[model samples]
Target: MAVAQLVAGQNITIPGDRAYCFSVQIADWQWGVIVSRQNGSLSLLDAIEGASISDDRLLLNLSDIPEDIEKLTVYIAAGVNNTGNRTANSSIAPTAGMSARLSDLVDAKEYASIDISQQLTGQLAVSLIEVYRRNGAWKIRCILQGYREGLSKLLESFGFTRDSYAAAVASISTSASTIATASAVNREQTDTQAPVNQEAGDASITLVWKSGQGSLRSAARYFMGKNFKPVSDLRIGCFYELENGQRGMVYSFDASLEGSFDGVPYIKASRAQNQHFEQLLINARFRHKLNRFLIFASMMDAHDSWGGLNVDVEFQLPGVAAQTLSPTTLMVKPIYAVAMINFNDEQTKMTPLDEYFQDLAEMDRAFAWGLPWQCENNSDNEDQT
Candidate 1:
């Protein structure tokens, strides 16, 4: 006894490849009935022709519904029908629940015809669905998928390996450990502290936090679409390693995220405290401490023949002797996308990211700067150390 409400701009893609329903809801979840848009009325049809670039938004036209309709809890998303996976919305609300970008989807028809050897070739990422709002908001959803099998094929040609990808993440710090601390200085430097841990191999440290608050966001599948939900200051990945070797993730800064259609450039949006915190973080990561390595990793560019990315993690080492990261100056972690592609390749073509890393390097560096990660990105920290 449940009825699904429909809206004017609402777009509902039927389960099968058959018909697309627009401008109408069933008479109380009554299967197969939809109000049509052509005649300014309601009508049931076996199938309707659909276009890739069309109205994806489901506008709830209350005037078109029957008088008996009760409980008008319409399900209207900021989008329209897509050719396949990821469609673009014209009037997307800043905080709408789910909005897909056309760039994230590979017109299967176009994909089947392209290959790594082909020019202007790229892969598809399950274009994340964002709920936008007027306040300029975007949030992730649980059901969204990033890169799928079809998109994986495209990335594979570039050295993305069937199960691999090229990924770069940039982390910026303020002057010093200031944003979250009362004693934090806004200048571009912090008191020169000793490099905490500098050893040849694996070493752990007591990651001290200015306070016990603040949440950190991660771009991994594990951290997707969690911001919109009720989250606390604890457990957003912002860690605080205490003297006793215990660590806790805190929710410290207000964060907003925005990305380009291509997925290459994403920004941690939000002007208030979030941006300030970001500037501070970036400054510390690059300018005073280990900023250069962080920049390289964040702006490196994503490619198919993506050799696993190298993270030049330069955080405050509270104790270890500051020696060059000899033996291995940086930690290289293969992107999850590339790894997935590698696995898919074994099942499909049978190659690896490690093998094609060299071949794809030239192509990757071509448009690296076009990405969000800039060449030299950092802000002025207060502590001028």
Candidate 2:
């Protein structure tokens, strides 16, 4: 018997297997060394949108907060109470001018909270941001990075809304603007089919319809009031009126848009073409206000099949509104949906044209023909999952 040990830079062969005998393979990965450096790219901000004026909150200290924020809400906080503000860290000598520009504008009479934006600039060494929490009766510090992303997203889901999303977009500073102008999407063709509240004047929708790849449309919904807070998750669906005065439903859904309003959650939805059905996801984000989003889908051709490759959606909340509409009762609605076209390559090659119709129909089916179980009816949605 012979004992042999083959080492690096050496080759050995014995049996007559042509494949493995001539080839050298490494199964173990050589992760040379563990580099311990500060987590620079890791973000530590949370975006929040309050549905009603009372639910206003924000996660600050990062240029990328929305990457994980859940929903943007608008609600009226009690009111603003001004106070001289400063940022202090007991960890070391406080940096001069490290003071937070914006203070928590809590309602003077009540403790309702509001948003105040300002730079946490000046001489600073700690790259961390100050996050205040109303603990019991005092404010406590809660950081994002060292903390959990899930927790951050959860905490920044709700916010206050005071203006129309359309108007809000128009107001964005040139530096922060992410959306580029394009011909209005299939908004005109489908706007009528959508369940729009025209009575809520000063609000208009833009849309465009595409065929293959898919269609893309974006719109901002606005409610009139000084300070507004969404008390319940708003319901969205499409409908078509029949010749006989009957109406058929289209897509109806509920998703917490960019739970956070800042980076980490901002959207940059642009483009005039639907290369691979990116439109479907845009349509999805329409339910909520988003700053940036990326949706992928497949369309065999320019005439058939249209859906998402994958979807990334986000949102942000405007300042609180003085008044917000309240529905008489909670409405049952869908949260998530998927559409499958019966067409295949053998039949006609799912092309752009067909994909357009498929997506439009999908929009219809999403609302009128959603899943069997309603998300509103689901205990999970009720429990805030």
Q: Report the C-alpha lDDT of model 2 over 129-171, residue by residue, as the tens digit.
A: 2221122112212111211222112223322122322233234
For candidate 1, the 10 contiguous residues with the lowest summed lDDT are: 108-117
Candidate achieving the largest lDDT: 2
Model 1 RMSD in Å is 24.1
203 Cα displacement, candidate 2 (Å): 26
User: What is the TM-score (0 to 1) of candidate 1?
Assistant: 0.18
The sequence of per-residue lDDT tens digits that candidate 1 reaches over residues 306-338 is 122221122322222432210121222211111
Off by over 4 Å in 1: 1-8, 12-191, 194-385
Where does candidate 2 stray beyond 4 Å? Answer: 1-172, 175-336, 340-385
Query: How do the predictions measure up, each by TM-score?
Result: 0.18, 0.20
Error of 1 at 35 (Å): 29
